[model samples]
Target: MSVTMSPGRYRGLRNVSLPAADTFGIVAFDQRGSYRKMMGAQASYAQLCQVKSEIISALSQSASAVLTDPIYGMDAAMRMSPRAGLLLALEKSGYSGDSSYRKTELIPSWTAQTICQVGADAVKFMVYYHPESGVLAEELEALIKQVVARCHACDLPVFLEPMSYSLDAAVPKASAEFAAARPAIVIETARRLSRIGADVLKLEAPHDIAHNQDEAAWQASCEQVSAASAVPWVLLSAGVDFAQFERQLRVACAAGASGFLAGRAIWKEAATMSSAARANFMAEVAARRLDALLEIAARDARPWSDFYTLPQFDATWYEAYALC
Candidate 1:
């Protein structure tokens, strides 16, 4: 079944969340459990929020939009991201089931309408997805379709991120075999999830940098992903080192990607530093890195307008708009 969406509602909102160029150089500050681990197991809530304040304050300057959770980073992004747009995370920190077949757990008492009421510009949901998950994949797909319907009803654009993982216990995720299989898995996942009423597909780079260094093959895989996705796609960093992630970003952009929504690769180093040091690093290093990525995106990435037809309206368009 085809998921329903009101294109007239979200196209303008989606354009508002992106920069003037419409290429996405988004900041992913939505890490929850991973953020706690970065801040250390014993780190207090204040300490974690402070870290968010420092990082989001600095990089939001260069970013087109900031992706943050409602728990800790929302306050920081609300204050710091004056020029950039805000995308709030709707799901919980981690998955529910075991690593073999993970399941997304959305936060209780949160709905798309409530997210809009909270003053967010857009909604983001990240789910663990795989083509071979059988029943689990169908369940996740259904959940995504439901979320999309809710969001579109409220006229909010949804950024859907589907993270891929290894299904076989014998071949661990870090193994070369898994890396070799990553391109096909990622491409097929994009094909599957892009049809589920998402306004934008936040995707993994099809080429695995750790196991492969072939730039040509990397670009080819990225181009395939671009072709497979029905909507415009942006690459996720997936916590690779900055240097390698930079390389991946370039290739993806060259292969017709819209831009990126990255997290750890840019600011993971500053999470462990003192407030002053973190501030300095974010301002000097992370901000500059974002500037560079934005430069790359401006040069090569396709604008999101390529996917959605931006609506033209008369001055009385809002008279017909539904506030419910």
Candidate 2:
């Protein structure tokens, strides 16, 4: 619960407009060609730079927020420009002889350097709690303090993501799972995070979204998360696709998600990075959706040209009138 203060001057970031309250900002990681390396192809530094350039160029002058994690090392991504916001993974390394978990030396040093190298105001650090590490919440809390202290010494703001550990029964794979668990466990996760110093509470949402059946269940979980932390809550998309991505965004925004720590959907398409033709194609698609929504939100008096058709407005009528 103790918040650390920095020794250096606090550089307040300029006021950047938040994405529409109903709109969950999209941030694409995987600039390093996804977390796990491919079989044959190795993602080179040059390729990562190319991806970074494309991301910056695509951002244009729009005030959208972005979060990019490093590929192989923190240096590559840290050295590059952060057009949106920058984030680096500080995954916990399992404990040694003692029951305490250790922060990978690279994490504390690189994270500190990242904030010092890149201005702290524009940078944020993301740490994942690995349950297999035998590091309990108390130990994890201390690690967070140490990490934050490093950031604070250099005057940086930190955003934290707290997750539950689970394994797929059939596959025998360990992963961060929060979707299907008893309410108490989820609440405990939130409470633990709150006891530590978490600026933004990023948690997993309920997997299934039924029409009316699971509303109370979902709401109960959400309330627990909110009650456990004073910080605003955002959801990790859990790797949803484009259509599902959009739907999930709408649902999250409606469910009071402050923002999203999303990957895949924004970066999944090869076209989004590879070729100019592909890049433009993806950009135009995004622009169409974003433009339409922004136009509606901005409420521009002038009649804007409808680049993409609004077929889904009314399903039956939309289906009947194919091209309006």
Candidate 3:
């Protein structure tokens, strides 16, 4: 079934412009410092751009959209794959200088109008969120309100991603305590962010198999997240291996997720390969991985448009923002 939306919302959705009759499949290459760590000491900004461009050229052919970061990869992405829908990352990472918990900061130069002028399909911000993260939550919420208002005025869609990290330096990132606390944190974060008017949410899977392997519990957690979100929500890969993420996506889609906006999981292995082998790996291995995920989404994921009630717009909304 199709959803009716306000003119502004419609314009935003149209900007995403996935293929007809297919699930939303966004290939995200928007990583910054974290990605460099993944690539080890040899990583350079130039190499990162080259690798991202290669992935877009090879994998975006079958995917719905591609997410790029303005700092390094946006130009190459747009140049290499002009037809793919582009979502530009608007935040700078590693603001906190701590490995355990990152604090996100918006890029000083990009604004809603600037992003739209650059032909982005949407603008995305990644906020590091946790209930006990001191004053960070308040700071992020204020920033989000400004972003949402500006995007609405410009008739551009805005995606909000709230990622949970442990604030305690003593706690190991992969510890059971961290995993156990994640589902509830994720659910609350979705609800709070959605209430502030995010057009779309990029969420982590509620339960990790390493800590919570019960299928029933996984379904229950996923249900809570789905119920909490006021707008359409998609799953993020969070650097899991491809096979594990495939399983998580199957579960998440069955529970209520719209689709996925994933990175790393689809191409991390390619990053580790020798430069001579990287292109072939992206064309053969990474492209196939992307296609496989898209197939799962087509067969099982919900359409984002189906998640919300249709909005009614008065004549002025159309006059001001309607696409001609």
Best by TM-score: 1
RMSD of each: 2.5, 14.2, 3.0
User: On residues 1-324, what C-alpha lDDT tens digit does candidate 2 reach at each position?
Assistant: 223322231121211113333222434443333443431256556655565545434542342344555444344345433443444444423223332333432333446545456543433444434444454545767877776666545554455665444423432112223334434554666666655554455566644332223555666566665566555555565555555645544444444455455555544554334567647854776544444333322332111111111212344543433210
Number of backbone collisions per candidate, in order? 0, 0, 0
TM-score of 2: 0.64
Candidate 1 lDDT, 12-39, residue by residue in tens: 3454345566788888989988788777
Give per-residue CA lDDT, model 3, range 22-51, as digits (tens).
346888888878778877787777887777
Please, what's the RMSD in Å of model 3? 3.0
Model 2 lDDT-worst window of ten: 300-309
Model 1 gets an lDDT of 0.84
Residue 217's lDDT within candidate 3 is 88
Winner by lDDT: 1
Model 2 scores a C-alpha lDDT of 0.45
Greater lDDT among 1 and 3 belongs to 1
Error of 1 at 70 (Å): 0.9
Question: What is candidate 3's local distance difference test score?
Answer: 0.78
**Lowest summed-lDDT stretch of 10 residues in model 1?**
1-10
